[model samples]
Target chain A: MVLMFKIFKNGWLDIFAALKGYELAGVLGWQDIRQRYRRSSLGPFWLTISMGVLIGALGLVFGNLFASPMKEFLPFLTIGLILWTLITTAVNEGCTGFTAAEAMIKQISLPLFTHILRVLWRNLIIFAHNLVVFPLILLVFGVPLPATALLAIVGLVLLILNLSWMMLLLGVFCTRYRDVPQIITNLLQVCFYLTPIIWMPNLLPKRASILLLHANPFFHLIEIVRAPLLGTLPSALSWQVGIVLAIAGWVFTIIFYGRFRSRIAYWL
Target chain B: MTNILINNLCVEFPIYNSTTGRSLKNHLMQAVTGGLMGSNEQGHVVVKALHNICLDLKEGDRLGVLGHNGAGKSTLLRVISGVYAPIGGSIVVNGKVTSLIGLSLGMDSEATGIENIYLRGALLGFNRSWLSSKVKEIVDFAGIGDFIEMPLRTYSTGMQMRLAFSIATMQQPEILVMDEWLTVGDADFQEKAQQRLQEIISKTSILVIATHSPELVERVCNKMIRLERGALIAA
Candidate 1:
């Protein structure tokens, strides 16, 4: 249909245009990170310090609760928390992509996706800061840095790609209906429990419950990165699930974006 | 060449129910429970912001738009700037447009004045290298030497206006769109701003200004139109 074709064209244009504006988005993203800690002496290291405390506390409590050894549990918990923060923060912030930039969106005709990329890029910077804690945890636990660990880059890239589409989709959706942001937040909160960020899927007694992990797009998303970082191959299923979600989400987003892209200005 | 072509353009804004205006819950409930019977089951009141209108503009055209409050002056400017898309008809614009509709159009009050220049400039689509070369010129024109280091909120309203005006007019745009006459700064700075604004306007190929001052229109515009309640009227 003409609508579908229009959406396809608009989607590609938006993406490439956003990429073309990477310098602007990159600077904006850095400004956000800098502004958040402007008055502080430690600056972004505060992120690392707070994350260190969080992972430490969670590692101790959960390690005892799960009765897993310190060596086994700490790295698992550390990687899980870091990846979760990267992902959940990206999703939650994506909802505000347009709404938060109401002044810019309403005043100028900048590509809408630039805001989305800014959010992702800002979160990635924070993720990079949090990643500093990972090597220390790995050293403390003496986890081997096998050759497979490099594969995490592929997973990280896929996760970023997937989140970009989600940003495009959710940014437009939430702008029109303000309550959508809160709804998304609540859903992500509930999903946090369901997706095994703090808990392991293997602990589920019934084999049928493993289907929960298998079906969860979030699990596959986290697993693709977490498994590789833990010195193991991510299940082929995670890659398959991640790629499928990326394709399907982009298809839906393109159509939805094409139909609603113009409405965004009105919505704001 | 700078140009804008619009045909039968109409823009309508949907006013959602007061309670459901921004609520996803009400919208989703209406969608799922109301079935697929009608799209307007949520009961939105639509406001026609701009009626069917046609206009053609090209290089060397200085079109002045005249309207009172709620008379679609800002809306028309926004439509031309591509901030708002029309609900009907079509528009084709060929130029790099700079919208100086608001004094602080893309500024962050919490950000320092120096940082805001880069932020606003980037929002206007200027690349880093160009901005780097223009920074000293813009700062000098703003005339707030030490204040530029402080947050914009700390600056006086006039100082803020000077900074915003300086940034907006730093580059010669192909299509310059403005909502009102930007007369800011003290008497001394005002004279300086006037000369700078005149220089920039001369460089612009197509200029669209929305204002209430007939003297301004007579002085600057070659063509003019009036609007009443979102409909064009005889000028």
Candidate 2:
């Protein structure tokens, strides 16, 4: 189709630029980290320790009430918590990606798409550090690492790709509306309980649980990625939903970026 | 040869007066949101910064701008540099441009003086290797001594001004734009800063400076124009 070809052609530069921009963003991120930890004794290790304390506390209390054994519960809880932290913090922090950098954006002529890439790249580096807690927990539980680990990494790549576009859309909308991110944050907090992160999907009433898993992209997002990390393959339907979400995310993000591309210079 | 064509450019800024036209609903929204969307009825005034203006400059043209504040001097520079778009005309600028509009636009105060040097360099469109090569040269020019290792925020007003001036002039570009005075630092440093400005202006093909400093304007500019309101007067 002519329309499909036009869409592909338009997005080609964005994909190429995103990769290049991410590399520069990584250097900027390293510069930021060194600046933050340069004088401090603890350095970047404090990030993992903080995550351990918060997740451990929540896991202990919730595991008891939810009737799942401590050994089984902690790993599930930790993985879900870590991923959600990444998703939420990325969306929340990215709201001001341009506004916060008014000084730099106004001064130089940088590709505005680079800002979206920068926020995603920084959050990903944080997520990389937080992953250390997961393997350490798995080792403590006497669980053997499986070949499924490779599959989970593939899932992680997909999840990151998906989240990158989601943040791009959310970041632009949030900048324009101001109230949108606050409302989205509040709703995500509520969705934390309704989604099967701390609790098992099996425990839910069949219809409601199935609906949540199929209808809510976040549910499929968590399962496809988290299930493999748990050394168990999940429902094939999650994969089905994931592929569709990927397509939708890319299309939506392209439209979002295209519409607001020029106005970004003025908003800052 | 670098040539810049600016045709029929116009810019306006909206001023929102909350004190004069504050409504109860606007106040309530402000209290909850901490920032306003600043739409109609809560007061808006338009100030046209640049009127319909046309100009053409080829290589070896050093144009000086003289105007009072809010008289569209900086606004003209911004429009030429592509930072602000003209509500009306089109601009055709051929060849690379390095703008030094604010002098020290992106310097992070928390960063060390050396780090700020590299950061500032990248911001002005310098690559890693070019900046690295110029590191010592820039530091020596700044003359801030060992304070280059300390946070830039700790630098005195004169020291910060030296760093900003040193970094902008270090890079040689086809077109150099100076907004306001190049006499930034103290009397001693100002002499060195002005010399650097002269050096860059000589090397560049087109030099457009927007400033109200009468002495500096007279000394450097071959062609000078004064602006009243948004219209250019006879040179």
Candidate 3:
């Protein structure tokens, strides 16, 4: 148990040490974005173009299928899809943060959290590219820029915090159990459907149990960001759940990282 | 002030069988089935890579680690570098360390030689401005000429080695840990590399080199130790 305490303490300290290398992490993140599109004319804007096309196509098809008007549907789907991309990209890439950088991890003595930061930063850059469509979508749908829109930044900040913990937690786990990445990929796929991304939660019969939406942590995450962008405050329940889950996730991560931190290098 | 003190350090690695070691699914199955099928096959097998290592070195000490393959020489270097924390005992190291175990370990193959130098430099904890200032010195020493602008994958193995060697030895390290005596490039370049390496060694406060050649131990190192099956053998 004393060993575990030391490991945990070391793990926490390493996280702070990694943060001090934010410049290195940011540079690495930028290098990744450039390397991915090297020699391509479009460069990172390709991300924006592809996302624009997907969102437009999905909005048209799903909007018609659900018999929802375009104005309401586009904003709902747009905000949801954007937040979903941010979440899924971080979660999916987090699984490989340490495993993919096996060479660097073994060779360099830099903080392990630096790798997590690099992953999150890279995904954040991609998310920014994807955001090019958000304002345009609002303009096309005539969604007003309500004062509440400022709160979306707060929601975004919270989302980033959530991703930091998720990446560290998942990165450590996936690095240890090689098959964990495959499992996580499959689970994220299932989660996409279960989350209220494509379909509306209100479509269900009135007075029907709201357990499906209420229980989903993803929904609250989306609501907090999406509701603010749509010019309204998210339900108190959403803010409470999102904040509670963020704290709990980080608490769980601190303990787990502390215990298994030393084992990571051996597992690799 | 550069020193390395390793006291009874131990490193253990669990050697999981192919079916169970690399897969979480197998572990889960074994757990669910109460180990009915995998009780024997999936049993934990741990390799004691290093056992009760005790050593100390101070400033200006050039130590050569001699051992057979899998004798934990590299593992010891890694532990000293802080890449691996000891499971038992402790290792105290003072001064900054530069390890050249795999000189090109973090270099990107698809990136240009210049970009790779920067990448490798970053891995060694050098900022861009610092690496940029040293780029000319490294490029001249490597003598790769115009190939420096080309991607690393286009370079021959020897050329890559020259680049790696030059970049690794460019800075005067307080503690220099190397895996082997690197010999690359033509005879002319080899002579130059040796001269530069010797100069660097003279300035380096501490040197730990792992090698099989007794001649290197005699010529370059003042102290020598041998490892067999992870245990330090008295020299």
Candidate with maximal TM-score: 1
Candidate 1 Cα errors over 4 Å, as ranges: B19-43, B150-154
The number of the candidate with the highest DockQ is 1
Give the alpha carbon lDDT tens digit for every residue of B1-235 in model 2: 6999988766655443324344643554344211222333325533456667777888988888987765677767766676665656778888777787777776778888888887777666677788889989998998988899999889998899899878878877897777865677788888888788777879998888987687877877777877766766656
Q: Candidate 1 lDDT, tens digit per residue, A159-222?
A: 9889889988999999888898899899988888888767766678787566678878899999
**Best to worst by TM-score, what's the order?**
1, 3, 2
lDDT against the true structure, each candidate: 0.83, 0.74, 0.84
Residue-wise C-alpha lDDT for candidate 3, range B1-235, written one tens digit per residue? 7899999998877655544553654455444211112223336655667888999999989999998887888888888888899978999999999886788886777789999888878777888898999998899999989999998889998899999989988888999888898777889889999998889889999999999898999999999999876788865
DockQ of 2: 0.33
Docking class of 1: medium
lDDT of 3 by residue, A1-268 (tens): 7876777687788888889878778878877987899879999999889888999999889899999888888888877887899899899899889887887778778888888899999999999988888888889877777789889888888778887898899999888777888888888888888887887776866554376688878888888888888877999998888788889988778778877777777778
Cand. 2 TM to true fold: 0.85
Give the Cα-based TM-score of candidate 1 against the true structure.
0.92
Error of 3 at A190 (Å): 2.1
Name the regions of candidate 3 deviating beyond 4 angstroms: A1-7, A206-209, B18-43
In angstroms, the error of model 2 at A13 is: 5.5
User: Model 1 over residues B43-151: C-alpha lDDT tens digits?
Assistant: 6645566776688998999999987776777888888888898888888999988887775765778889889988878877888789889988988988889888999
What TM-score, computed on C-alpha atoms, does each candidate reach? 0.92, 0.85, 0.90
